[model samples]
Target: MSRVLIIESSARQQDSVSRQLTQRFISQWKAAHPADTITVRDLAVNPVPHLDANLLGGWMKPQEQRNTQELEALARSNQLTDEVLAADVLVLAAPMYNFAIPSTLKAWLDHVLRAGVTFKYTETGPQGLLIGKRAIVLTARGGIYAGSASDHQEPYLRQVMGFIGIHDVTFIHAEGLNMGRDFHDKGLNQAIARLAEVA
Candidate 1:
């Protein structure tokens, strides 16, 4: 059975297009692979702590040298990193905020991308450790920005995912969410249709 790890970052619990996409994905994925294990980490409900001195110390210092707080931070990072490492498929649900991803999601990424755990410095260049994993990103945007330079979300996510050895990534964007009724209907319907095809 494949392991699927889903990270949900949308702040809106009631009406979030990203969350809708994830719900659909979960249903379809479960139907297709009945035995696959699915794990979800909802950042909106339980935000991961941002980078701090304690976490930094935990990452840099050895176990014998780490303090209590540092050890706790290290343990948290280990758990998050291990989830990513164990997953066969990774799904990130992001709702665009200020032309970028949510801060909560960014914090989660910071924990997951470790120095020697998820990536390593090599003689030639930095090498990723979490290889042979597939990632699917579901994004909800207020305006259309896919394939444009204004869309900072996809490029940033692609770089980070590739850095951790998840090179095969697919993005499904639901754009023009805040636009007028016509645009909203069209964009949402299109995204849902594509979701069905892709899921």
Candidate 2:
């Protein structure tokens, strides 16, 4: 059976549009693929630690020379990396914050996107290690910013996913959530319809 890893990064547990989209995606996905296993990692609930000196040292230092703090940091990174490595599909719920993705989500990405693990240097350029994996990004934005220069979320996410060999990625954006009731409803409905088609 396929394994699906979902990353939830919305700060608000209640009244979260990104969470709503994820719920719908989960329901639809389960209906379509009943045997597939799904795992959800809620960053807001238990946020991963941001990259620090210990983490960097843990990654760079030799195992025998590593200290306790570094070892613990490495262990945590290993767990997060292993989860992503084992998953067949990756789903990310990224609620836009100041025109970018949540810091928690970014921290999780930092843990998994490791050199010589998720990617490696090649003769031509850097190459991604994780292959045959797909990703789906569900984003909620305050203003309309899709395909525009101000839409930093999509482009950055696209590049990051591609860096890890997840080239087959689809983004469903729910924009204008804070721009009046009409825009909110329209954007949400459009995203839902797109998700329905995708899921």
Candidate 3:
């Protein structure tokens, strides 16, 4: 059976547009693929701790030489990485915070993108280890940023996902969410329609 991971980073539990869109997408996706197993990681509700000096040092150390403290620090990273590696599909609900991704989602990415696990530096340069997984990024932006030259969130998300070897990444953006009530409803409807097509 296919394993799908849903990572939600919105701090707003019920009112988050990103979360709404992701839920719609997942519902449709399940309808399309009933046998797929779904796993959810709600980052806002259960936030992962940021990488500190101890965690960094532990990650850099060779596994065979790691001490008890280092091993403990590495455990979180290992679990996060293993989840990503085992997934056949990933759905990320990312709401733009100050024109960037939320801290909760960023923390999860830090734990998963280990040097020797998710990625590594080779003679050719850096290479991503995880492969053959498809990702759908459901993003909610306050204003209209799509197709704009100053939109950093979309490109940043794409770049980071690509770096982790998830090149087949699709973005479903629900933009103009904070513009006005009418605009927000319209944008959400459009996003839902798009989700129907893709999911």
**Which candidate comes out best when scored by lDDT?**
2
Per-residue lDDT tens digits for candidate 3, residues 1-199, read 7899999999999789988887887799899999999999999888988878768867887878788877887887888888999999988999989888899998998888877777789999888777788988889998888878767777987887788788998888898899999999888988898899887
lDDT of 2 by residue, 1-199 (tens): 8999999999999999999999999999999989999999999999999999999999999989899999999999999999999999999999999999999999999999999999999999989998899999999999999989998999999999999899999999999999999999999999999999988
RMSD of 1: 0.9
The C-alpha local distance difference test score for the whole of candidate 3 amounts to 0.86
List the candidates ranked by TM-score, beginning with the highest: 2, 1, 3
C-alpha RMSD of each candidate structure in angstroms: 0.9, 0.7, 1.6
Q: What is the TM-score of each candidate against the true structure?
A: 0.97, 0.98, 0.93
TM-score of candidate 2 to 2 decimals: 0.98
Clashes counted in candidate 2 amount to 0
Ranking by lDDT: 2, 1, 3
The runs of at least 3 residues in candidate 1 whose Cα sits more than 4 Å from the true structure, single-residue gaps closed, are: none
- In angstroms, how far off is 142's CA in candidate 2? 0.8
**C-alpha positional error of residue 147 in candidate 3 after TM-score superposition, expressed in Å:** 2.7
